[model samples]
Target chain A: MSWELTAADLPDLARGATLLGTGGGGDPYIGSKLVERVLGDGAITVLDPDELPDDAFVIPTAQMGAPTVMIEKIPAGTEPVLALRTLEEHLGRTADATMPIECGGINSMIPFVVAAETGLPVVDADGMGRAFPELSMETFAVYGVHGSPLALAGERGERVIIDTGDDDRQMERLARAVTIRLGGVGHIAEYAMSGADVKRTAVPRTISMALALGRAIRVAREQKRSPFEAIADTLAPTLYSHVRELFVGKVVDVDRRTTEGFARGLARIAPLDGGDELEIAFQNENLTARRGGELLAIVPDLICVVDHETAEPITTEGLRYGQRVRVLGISTPDLMRTPEALAAFGPAAFGLDETFRPVESR
Target chain B: MSWELTAADLPDLARGATLLGTGGGGDPYIGSKLVERVLGDGAITVLDPDELPDDAFVIPTAQMGAPTVMIEKIPAGTEPVLALRTLEEHLGRTADATMPIECGGINSMIPFVVAAETGLPVVDADGMGRAFPELSMETFAVYGVHGSPLALAGERGERVIIDTGDDDRQMERLARAVTIRLGGVGHIAEYAMSGADVKRTAVPRTISMALALGRAIRVAREQKRSPFEAIADTLAPTLYSHVRELFVGKVVDVDRRTTEGFARGLARIAPLDGGDELEIAFQNENLTARRGGELLAIVPDLICVVDHETAEPITTEGLRYGQRVRVLGISTPDLMRTPEALAAFGPAAFGLDETFRPVESR
Candidate 1:
């Protein structure tokens, strides 16, 4: 399905993105505002992956850096288009459409901003179904897409175009360093591919999923029903095989620190009903969710935190002590469950001793 | 004033470059070996800066990152030519000549290796008369050269081409980050300019000076004369206005750390006769030399530490406690004393409370 996104859709989109962010990707408030300002009364056309022609050029883009830094040093609003232009110049072709690299927090809305600025339609898909901290943890990487010829642009008109050949890990490492130097935030356009590749590798319809998710939360709040139930029901019809409410609790402690250009730490959630506590460790996004020594959710799956009452999504940077919250775990898309994908982003990849277990199994 | 640099010149070149390194620029031992292996029996042509044509394209190249890192992860012997190729592709023109970005440590030998591999002549000049830590602290920066369109290449075929647009400080920051990401070391080719611009901005004949300095040290050692006296005599006819023996001491303490892609620390040299101790603080290169708060030499002047008997220049990375050493202060080239030059590399710029006073004055 195709849709036209207008100014009215910004709030819902931001809300949906935050929910899908799963406690990372920074706050979507600034991105939402920037998009709203750039969008004005103009409506942006959102295209389904199937709608794209095989030969159509496509570009995936997102902000690369620490979430904490992105909140403080708000983007100059020119980086996305600048990155797109730089990429276009490098590839010697114009992009037929733009897409979000990840469906998480601020990144989910960045494509819309670019589309609004460049008059390029946004494909309703993303590389990661939900945000993963590192660039190598993307569905595109699993699908063997080259991450190089990546264009990184800073607000100060500084631009770096990287060509890392077949080493995606090195690309991630280099891009992260560039991001830190660019005031800990830089806009990057990577994995330029044909529309055919997009259809093959992308997590399709994520934009629509985010929109529906946002609408569900809004409607649930108005109806005075539990937003957690609404969220689970909202994700039930998606590509995700399972959506379960993991815990209802209050944040008791947050051991967070901004290190090496990342917001890394742990959040301890104490059950309001006085059962076992849930501990979530994160490097930018929530990596693993555990109850005592047992695992509830691990990476390559969605481990999200939301407000206890209104069910507003809380990003990792927004986590604080004494805040009542609800945690949800959604099974990852089947495409992300393969051995290759698991090896790149599984619990063990993050230094956990446990074997791979689906959120559905938990 | 063209000369062929054969295997015979490697020792003197390394020795001379080390002296000019002024207790920074890392060790040249590995670089010398790399160049020697690459050069084999081939002779590289060294062109005088004045001999370059008006339309000839020239680039100043060097290694940018912490010296300590460079010693460990040795170059794959392809970064220089790779960076040159990347730059040439970006500019849509081939390089006519190459030169060291600075006449310090490993950098002074990199161009020779490139010339051996690429069959390109190296200009007998450099952007800095001696090495300074930051990219902005160069004769090219002082003479209004743009540092952008700089190519940075890593060993893993990772390449980043930066277009910084006249902001040298931003260039330095971004390059440093890129270097750290490239395993704390990267080959950088910056300030690509016309031969006219190269002649106008470059510190001419620094290569010949390094050669002379190296040759003098070798001769003194062979003749059983004090190498320090030989060094002073060798520097008498150079652009440097004065050369003075600052201290004869034994290294008592050395404080150093690789931080933010730089070898940063202070080295204390206690007089062998039990006089005041001299402290040299450095960030990659020695920035200041003082005794009990009395400044002896500060950059852009050169403060070099050498073996007390052999006069072998000890790079900042090679400094060690309990070693008998001699410190020498040499006045900077007139081109580096301009107010614009001082502002970029002066004492105050390095967070020192003192103003830049000429080494010749004290």
Candidate 2:
């Protein structure tokens, strides 16, 4: 298949991104619009990782900071390319290509702006098939990739380069804090890699994966079938059974804590279908899902509580009493199924003593 | 040194912590009182890392949230131990030792509480000699240690665990969000390193360094001298320079932004000393300092602005008009000396073009 992103790919890309987000990457609507406004009709050329030359100068780009702030604080929109250019200046070399950090959610579309403005083609792959938090948390870090002399450019008259210890977390910490300081949004060029590292560390064909999922969901919606089932089918992942929700109805309670420049809160849902209640607590993303006295879902996995009708991502802070939602459960990939991952996000980690078995096993 | 914490040491500990914070970590008052209140006159045995047994089970504990919040919602005192006990239960093991993630601020005092309640001796060193912006940004992550089986216990009212792909950022992102959701405070036991990993990965003797610096400051103050000079005398580091106030007067203008859950802001300071005015910016911690368009300090070295008279940590969110402050500069060890560190923290990273020289050189 000839790989090119056109206006037609936007919707599919956004939908696919949400599925890939596994429930925590933030709403794709705003991020999708940013891409759509930048490039339309012209197909984004997708370069296969294998097709890149060994010496290919490739860098992944991303937005770092508060998603809610993204809505209130309009991006300068030029920072993404400026970030790429700053890297080029620091190294005195131009990038041969660009890629996304995650194919799901807003990150899935960031490369489009880079492509449109810089005239660089967006790679069909990404570092993660799904969104993972932090600048250093990528497989690239595991491969010994470093985020130093990072090129950061914000539309609001801010730009800088960060070089840190071989530790990408340092870069992530400083850059993240910087972005928050820069009105909650900043773009950066990171994981500056040789084509070889790009291929070895990044998820291959994540763009196609996103497109496929989006297409699947659209097809299901068009055919009047279950979009949720379609997504589960396409991802080859099953829904966890023990995810019996506490509320099938409206939001009845929300208690918020706003500190550390973040908005955090919990929402209680009362079942329309009949049950005790459900609580979905969130900061910038949904973290824990519980119903009655039973634990439902934990982190490092997508625990989506979507608008029962729209299936759109609703931020935790935006939720209010009497709002309707249906909590959805999604199993995670093996990459996050390692002993390390389970230890970080298993039932035990989230205050639940129940062993987490794959829905398939259950 | 009998390696026993004495009563006189408490004041030094708190004061030194405020200094080491580099103007980012919150006030140490609450944390200090909590520890002092619980462990009155109890000897907190500080074991040099070298003296630690190879089989010793050590867990470093700290509070995760915005420093601004710490001043408002003082911890319930039991939060730290609750987090640790919850972690012990999840690990299905017991901890033989407690350590601070960093020794520069409130975190410096958390281990004391843990030691008093659990009867675990505190380690004498820390991961980062100073405070960092995020949990993943710790010295442990740079050592290829995974921060898993990391349990977070909330004030006994809520407890949750989080696991992420070997990505510390993901862990931070997930954990931070959960912390916010649970009402802005939680205790975390992270980087559960085996005995060997702890030795190689941790920044050794951090506790001693903190105490030494604390003692130095106290002795210097009693003798009537500059506290900044006291720190310089103690660090015996390669560089130390204290800037004469451009303006000792009131704060004039403040710009603020909260993104990615950080209270970021910048303020202008007029000189009461009859010099020119100065502009400073911050996010939880101060990242840059300038006077009359000239850049004075930038990261990975530290730039801290404190009350000119009282060494209180002044967060960016807390910086206001008319607040008198003296800017202090210090150099981090080799971690911030590498080319990578320079690029990540130099003036270029902070949006200035000139290379950052030592403050003492200036």
Candidate 3:
């Protein structure tokens, strides 16, 4: 079904997208402001994958750099539009719609901004159901979509077009270097594809899923009920299943630094009652979680950290030394857990030693 | 006036270009091989700037990276062709001619390779009468030619186009970062301009000057005369005049390393009879020379090091300890010594503390 997203939907969308980010994808509050500024008194048509013609041309848009840097250097709100236009000019074709490259805080909202500016509808699907650091981590790249012929724009209106011709790793390497030189952040339009390709490769209805998850958490708070239970109930019917609260603890340590265009770090959470500690490691998005030397979840699954009481998602850059938090382990979709998808974004891909094991199995 | 450049001209051109390079611009021998392989039985048309039509499109081509890296990793000879083609496609116009961005070893020869492959005439001019480390340090940029919309290609056939509007420094920063990711060497086509702009801003007749200098040294050697005196005679009537041999010494120390895509180093040469030492500092191209605490020459002037007996120019990457050498200081063209040009390529721009004093004035 086609739906509409207005300024009023931003709060819920931001909250839900933050949860899906696992622990990265930049700050949601800033993304919300950028979207609201451009979306003034307007509604964007959100099309389901089935609603699009097979020949529809879609381009995925997102920001590429350290999330921590985005906090200091907020985008000028014109970057995504410039990036999209640059790509459109390069391709010599008008885009039928815009879509998110990943389901993450700012990345999910960026498409809506581009849609508002270009008057193009947005697809409710995304390449990654949740965020991962590198461009090649997406299902679109893992399956068949080319990530090159990518357009990147800086806040200063500087533009660059990269064409690596099917070398996705080279694209990531070159783009990261450019991003660092662009003052640690750049907006990108990449993975241009057809509607049929999207239908075959993307995780469908992720925006709708995020909306439902947001509403569930909001309603649970209103009824004075456990938001975690509401989250479990909300995701029970979705492709991401087997949600569980792994631990509730006070944050004891967070060691993070922005390096090579990524906010990479490790956080340790100690049980309030003095039980075993939970350690979460992240590169942009959380890649691994362990409790007392036992692996609870790894990448290709979701390891999210949230506020203990309010259930608000805390990004990797926002992790603090003394905050009460809850860690949640959720199983990814079967498509994302397959050997091919795992190889693209698994523990091993991020230089982790262990093989991927599903959250449900754990 | 116009001339033809065949494979027979490459050896002499390489020798003279290496001399003009001062101490950078990659290995001239490798560049000679690359141009020879491409030239085959064909001869490229070398046109003086006045020969170009007012509306002719000209693009300057060069290699951008550390000279040391190019020695171990010779180009596939296809990178410059790819770079020129990429830029031409971006501009939506066929190039009428190609020229050197600078008069330096490999850089001066790269346009010949591009011209041979593209069937484009080679302009007998260059942006820099001599080389500087950064892209913006060119007469073309100093005198109002735009350097953006630049195309770069690596040996792996990776292509990137950067458009920074009029921001030349940003173009250099971004291009350098990309070149590093391209494994320390990339061929670039930049400074796209009209024939009018080339005639107004470029150092004219540099190709002819290099050829004359090469022939002078060769004839002097055959007659058992002084090559240094022959060099002085060859340059006396050109825009670059006031040539003088500053020191004859044995190199006692060389502290050099390849960093951030540049060969940066300092060479200390002690007098043969145990007198004052001459110290030369270089970043890609030699920037400054001092003898016993007295400045002898600084950029926008040329400080070239040559074999004491053979007169073969040694690049910064080729500098070694315990080599006998003679340092020559030559005044640059009056066009390059203007306040604007000095501000672009002078000592302060290279992080030296002294103001630029021409070799003749010193």
Candidate 4:
């Protein structure tokens, strides 16, 4: 599959993306703006993971830090290139390159921006095949690929060369330190792998998957199809929802001090579902989802809030009490289902009573 | 050197450590109490770097995050050991010993708590002979040692492992992600290396150095030795000025919106030094110490504010306009100079007009 993403494609991509975001990928609005800035009306060509050569230098790159922070202190957009260039210099090798680190919400277009700047093709695949909170939690980590010796370059000519020598934990530690130093934002080039490594580690053609899901919503809206039906058709999944997002509410409080950018406080969601009530406790991303004392979605899965009609991915910071919202759930796949991953993302991981059971199963 | 710290040792250590903290290492008081909680009447043993066997496993562990955050959310005092134990488990080996990652404020005594709990011999050597902000700006980085496969364990038992396979920058990205996830404060055990690696990379005798310095300040204060003189005797070359602290007045404003728990913000200082007024801008540690008309100590070198006569370290967060304080400058060593180390903490690194001139030469 090939993607020639013109300016016309972005709207549908984002519209469909909110459904795929499952309730936690963060708002695509900021990233969409950046994508538009870079691509303009040009075509964003995306290749299928299988179509690429076996040994292409497949790198997974993105901004890995608090999304809450990124919302406030915008990226210079130049850090991504600086990181890539520095990584190239450090490797003493140049390569057949590809694009974006992940496919969902904002990260989905990073490849296009990077490709436009560095002339590298954006790989249609992504580790985890979705957005995650940590670098180590990606499918690359599931395999033996390490995201180290990462070139964390800020746009302001401040480049941090972090080498954590085969230790998975240290890579995140140092990257985090740089993230804070760089005003809570930094572009990263990581998981520097051969095509062989890419084939084994990455979830192939995840962007196509995203595009397909996106197109589903597109075709749906065009054909008067329900948003949930369109998304489910695109994912080829056996499950999905019919909720429409209507986000317009007042944020009661933003307790950033304790939550530390994790969305913790309740966002009163006076649903267009005509329900009595809905509330969310967020940390970084949305965590628990509830409606009128009914558990809509627990943990270990995504509970995304979108603009009820527009399907705009809503972040915890953006959601407010007394506001209206449409909530939806997206399932976690096998990659984020392992014990380690579960330990990081499960209901128990967030200190909920229930252990991690699959979203579909739960 | 041996230290039998009595219940009475807390105040002097707190004061002296603060003096050594310069202006950026969080409040020494919170850290002082923590050290006191773990160290009560124990005969503390300080060893020279040369004392350890060449092959013994030595690790320097400390908390890595925003110092200001540590106060509101104190550690369970379990983090240092958790980092230690996690590294040991990752290695499938036990640590024969532990050492201070650095000797800045709370970090100075972190090893002591680890020692008392794990019963491991706390080696006297430290990675940074003195304090520098970034985790990688240590003597270990000077010796080409990496700071990863390092584990950060939180009080709530949340842990993430960062291992960047010798790529320094990658580690930072991940660690910070964990830090933000953990409410902006976390404990990290970075730069996992063997005794040989430790021997080559770690600053020799940092423990004895700190103990001597700690003891000297104690003895001098009691024996009528000027505490300043005692400190001068310990560190060799010295430069001191009774520069007033910024934020001497009431903390009229605190910009927490952009603060991800970093020690950041600008404060106006009404100088009590008989010098003109001063203003200071800070990030984590104070980077620039500027007089109203003159650039005193710029970045790359450490600029700390101590109490005018007590030699106590003053954190930037508590700085108001009407306070009385003294500022001191301590230069970084030349041996630990590397592009990354320098880039992370060099004079040019912090946007100063100054070229890199050795303080001794200047």
Top-TM-score structure, candidate number: 3
**Which model is ahead, 2 or 4, in terms of lDDT?**
2
lDDT of each: 0.87, 0.68, 0.89, 0.62
Question: Model 4, B33-148: lDDT tens per residue?
Answer: 67668766664555555666777877777876777676677788877788788667656778777787776667777777777677677676677655656676666765678786
Q: Per-residue CA lDDT of candidate 2, range B6-98, in tens?
A: 555777787777667776666666777887888887877888788887788888899887776667778878878877876676567888888
Candidate 1: Cα lDDT at B110: 87
Q: Write the per-residue lDDT of candidate 1 for residues A128-176, one digit (tens) a residue.
A: 8888788877888789787889999999999999999867778888888
Tell me the lDDT of model 4 at A206.
66
DockQ-derived CAPRI band for the predicted complex in model 4? incorrect
Error of 2 at B157 (Å): 3.0
Q: Which of the predicted structures, 1 or 2, would earn the higher lDDT when compared with the native?
A: 1
Per-candidate chain B TM = 0.98, 0.86, 0.98, 0.84
Local error of candidate 1 at residue B18 (angstroms): 1.1
lDDT of 4 by residue, A86-205 (tens): 677666777576655556656776666677766667777776555555555566766778777677766565555555556655676657665665666677888888877776767676
Computed on C-alpha atoms, the DockQ of candidate 2 is: 0.02
Deviation (Å) of A80 in candidate 3: 0.5
Model 1: CAPRI class:
high
Cα lDDT tens digits, model 2, A198-293, are 877666777887787678777877888876666667666321222222235788888876444445567788988686787776654556677777
DockQ of each: 0.83, 0.02, 0.91, 0.06
- Interface root-mean-square deviation (Å) of every model: 0.8, 16.0, 0.4, 9.4
In terms of lDDT, the poorest run of 10 residues in model 3 chain B is B342-351
